[model samples]
Target: MATYIISSFRNHNKHVTYTSLISTSVNHTQILEEFHKFQYMQTKVFVVHGSPSISSRLFSMAKDVGMMSEGYTWIVTSKTTNFLKFMDSKAIESMQGAVGFKSYFPKSSKFHGLKHFMGLKEVDYDGMWAYDAVYALAMAVERLQTKKHVTKLALLDHILRTTFRGLGGEFKFVNERTLLRPIEVKNVIGKGDKRVGFSIVNGEFVKKMGKTNSSTNNGLEHIVFPGGHTSILNHRRLQVNGKKMRILVPVFGGFKNILQMVVDPKTNLSNVSGFCGDVFNVAFNVLNHKVDIEFVPYLFEEGRTFNDLIDKVYYKEFDAAVGDITITSNRSRYVDFTLPYSDMGVGTLVRNADKSIWIFLSPLNADLWFTSAGFFLFLGFVIWVIEHRTNEEFQGSTTQQIGTTLWFAFSTLVYAHREKLESNLSRFVVTVWVFVVLVLTSSYTATLSSLLTVQQIALKGGSVQFQGISPVKAAVYNNVKLNEDVLVELRSADDYAKALRNGRVGAIIDEILYIKSVLALYSRHEFSLVATSSTTNGFGFVFQKGSTLAKDISTQIAKLREDGTLKALEDKWLERQSSIMSNDFPAVSPNILNLYGLRGLFLISGVSMAFALLVSMVYLAREKCQGRSKMEMLRRVSKICPTPSTCTR
Candidate 1:
């Protein structure tokens, strides 16, 4: 029985060093022919493997083993064949040779083989024997277990002189880069459980199903070659078989482009003159060439300002701008533009607090009604008191009842209270009063509820901070005019205002409403708005003309637009009162996104309304009970007093 182990590694790019170094090793055909020419009696070689880095480590072990010594015939076996077939063959034939098998790993590439059914799909690993050989050598040394002060050279002698069983087979020392291991061949069991004869050790067939121990009674059955270190098996048991080209896309950004910022390393675009839609459409088409896109962002950095980044005709200084770029007549002379994706719109941004429900429920709004109710009740009390003072006939009548009844009407509206009466006429009055009180209570509650609802809706909608901002002005100020106008890019709104005041830039062109509001808020820095013939310069990609890639991309973009996909993206971003850059500004120091800002305002308002209602109900109920009890007690005491006719003045 003759067996040889082989493995090899080479650069994927097929570098020259790889070819030169790997060429020295034996090929699969040469290895097979050598095996056929076997002149030796029962022999087996367990090959070791390591990549570029691991190969160096194996070389160190070989030096200590003296495999490279002058007297030794150093025959480094590099046969790239699967030795399993030699172990398995009845006459010595086992497995197929394959190359580039690392592709079978789970992450890199995927493959399905016959062994996959046994749960061994991604079992491919590198440098297996370089490490495994160390284990086999360690086991052999453990078997000796001698404490006779063994030196490195003596230990090397001990290993090379003994034999033992190891993971590969019968562990025995050969020359450098080679290990003689006894092979164990088992019968081939068919998928149906039919078994055939197989080799027991080193390619020799043996039938033994009982317990077998590799260790002998005297010592271990495997020995290590102390002077020899294993080599990194580069050539594996495989052939190239085929070749194909594949396109690869590395991940550039995170979180699906949700936070594509102007200052970010990737997607840094120049000012382009286009509405938000056109700029983003061009950018998306360029980045993603897929025909069918599930989602797309509406506003991107390319259209962030009105600047043209791409050059169609050609210039010397720069090529194109990715973010918003100024599109001017000069720019048109040099560059081309794609069809407009969406028109720009100027809109308002309102604060959430201004439209909150609490704002409408404020005391100021209800003050007039409360005051009217109080004044009427006061007038009725004063009239009843004056009538009692001036008319003798009216003195006998219950002026107290009139005052109390009138006051109760006031309390009922502002607070919840009812009056108690004794006379039959008073009883009739009280019944009517209760009915009127219920109706008034329901009306006030309903009105308050509706007002609160409207306030809530308004708050949710938010107050427009800036109204009707002109994109044309923004284009001019952002230097989107390019060579047509001498304008500087304003990093921030404040900077633009400063430039306007300092007369550094001709005019601060921006969305008009935002500038107006900003100016109003600042009180300094005033500039005149420069009006221009606004051309709806849509943002577009600047690709080499007649390129097939460009054509394919344009088709995909058109499909996205036709199916309302682009519109959906627009609705997602443009409908918002503020842009992403606007919300991210440092003024407010919002710890989280603006979405949290809106939602938090609603949550606080709802909680406050609920709390206020609870307090108001408690206060109203207590006041009502106290006023009625005090009035009834006074009436009872008056009835028990001395007769009015005989009482002293």
Candidate 2:
């Protein structure tokens, strides 16, 4: 029967568990006390199966222990309820408000006659079954009397085949020997019981005969369960010792916008409000069960950490801990945590540096700048060699030629040069160089624009600071590599800003959520988040170790995240403080252009210049060979490439 109940629940996608409390020698009080050790909030429905004496005592003990309350349910099997008539009135009274199942037999003239013969006003199901067994044996004997054989085997065969409508509903064999009938679902009332429904052959409930008013969806009539409640009890109304659940929240000096506790002067009641509070409220609203909660604030002291706050839950001082509590491995050993609703990571908040006078050169590093300058000089020499003999623009003294060459090379950056090309070799070199210049100029412009618009800072080999109250500060120290002497502890956002402004600390290291709160509190433009490390889990609600409420609330938190409620809460509580900040200054630094990023463009330009120089040299060699006299060719070349001394004469 227990297996059937479990399977039926599983078929409907509902979880069910069966616990056996049957002890051979233990007293009823010991068994009941042992059962009380299980969490009532976790397990609601309990099915009791035993003889009438033991079950009656257990039912009375359950009522005394407050288990027969609004959030609990007690059920009994036919083993106890089938013989309820033999028990006294006190035993029946103790079973009040309990639901039980018993073998059902329809009322007929034969049933009444059997009850009258037994001299009893009411006959229980066991009495009816005995009457049906006697009637079936009589029918089998009559059938065998017609046959010549009176053997034991022949009598058993006749009994198996016999069918009749006796005191019981149907006195017939199904599947060769077993009789099947419906079971009545009864609610224990004043002195008797009420027929609420019937469990048919398939273990499904059907309304009692001639009853159309059903209170529950399971086709059962109105049931007065334990605690005299007419409606069904779900698991959500769990209480701690029959009172509201007490939750501990941290009331500290820093990051109050994330979590804060305020006391009303008149009422002396504490109210919690902030991003963490809003998240908890939203998650609680969507929970499957209803749980009353009370918020108790733990005043922060110098040496007390969040670990101490979580320890309160472990020691049973509070049912749970909720606030901006980080989930860490050390704390997880003592308590369970819900899924993190905030963003994870440690952020580095540093003061924005003043813009430098030479900010134009900030886009490219030294390697890229030096490489570009060298390529400019090389391309100028190559073009001059190719055009020196043929083009009049190239005919000049050494100083004049040097000035013109450098002018032509650098002018390609703006595409503004007066010199005209006479050789295709020189034009081809210029064309390729111009393309390379175009790519370099465009990259420089984009990178420089980002630097000018966004605040830039550096934080290498400088002192760091963090909130001393944060439990994850040690993790931040290990990730960012801070020394004992160089670490500064601050308590508030204003202190963080003051320390950075006066150069007391180079960077402030903390969780991303706390860093964001600091940015929102002050002028976000003055401070920027430059670096981040994913070293710790974000903030979550805390519960006692092995508490099922933690898992239930975690499921609700996930749903809130998926539906965007969590984001809306963040914007309302956290993002609104920094409404003046724009999307231009993100939480990370912009990428800087380097020599490695433009290596291919420089490679293409170098190859083109080399090819042009080779072609020009080969053409000049052929022309010199075609000249009639070597002296005449020499005179021509000397006139084109005059020395600085000759140009002065």
All models: lDDT?
0.35, 0.78
Q: Over the stretch 1-649, how does candidate 1's per-residue lDDT look in tens digits?
A: 1111211211222111111122225455554443332211101122224342222333333344332222121211222112222232321111111111111112212223323544663332333334346765676577568676667775576667555543233456676324553222221121111111222333333233222433342121221121222222222111111211111111112212211333224745322222243434454545543332222122324343222223221321121223233234444544444444433222212221234455433322354445435434643343333333334433454765575546654654454444332223323333444444454445446555554432111212211111112245444434433343343445444555554454455443444233433433443223322232234354344322222233344565677688877656554544332322232221221121122323343344334434444554565588789999999998876787656664444
Q: Candidate 2: lDDT of 58? A: 74
Q: Could you tell me the lDDT of residue 5 within candidate 2?
A: 65
Candidate 1 runs further than 4 Å off: 1-360, 363-371, 378-406, 411-558, 561-649
Q: Which candidate is the best by lDDT?
A: 2
Candidate 2 residue pairs in clash (backbone atoms < 3 Å):
236-289
Candidate 2, superposed: residue stretches over 4 Å from native: 1-22, 27-55, 75-92, 99-186, 190-219, 233-244, 267-308, 327-348, 462-495, 502-509, 529-540, 543-576, 580-588, 618-649
TM per prediction: 0.24, 0.67
lDDT for 481 (candidate 2): 63
Clashes of 2: 1
Best-matching candidate per TM-score:
2
- What lDDT, from 0 to 1, does candidate 1 have? 0.35
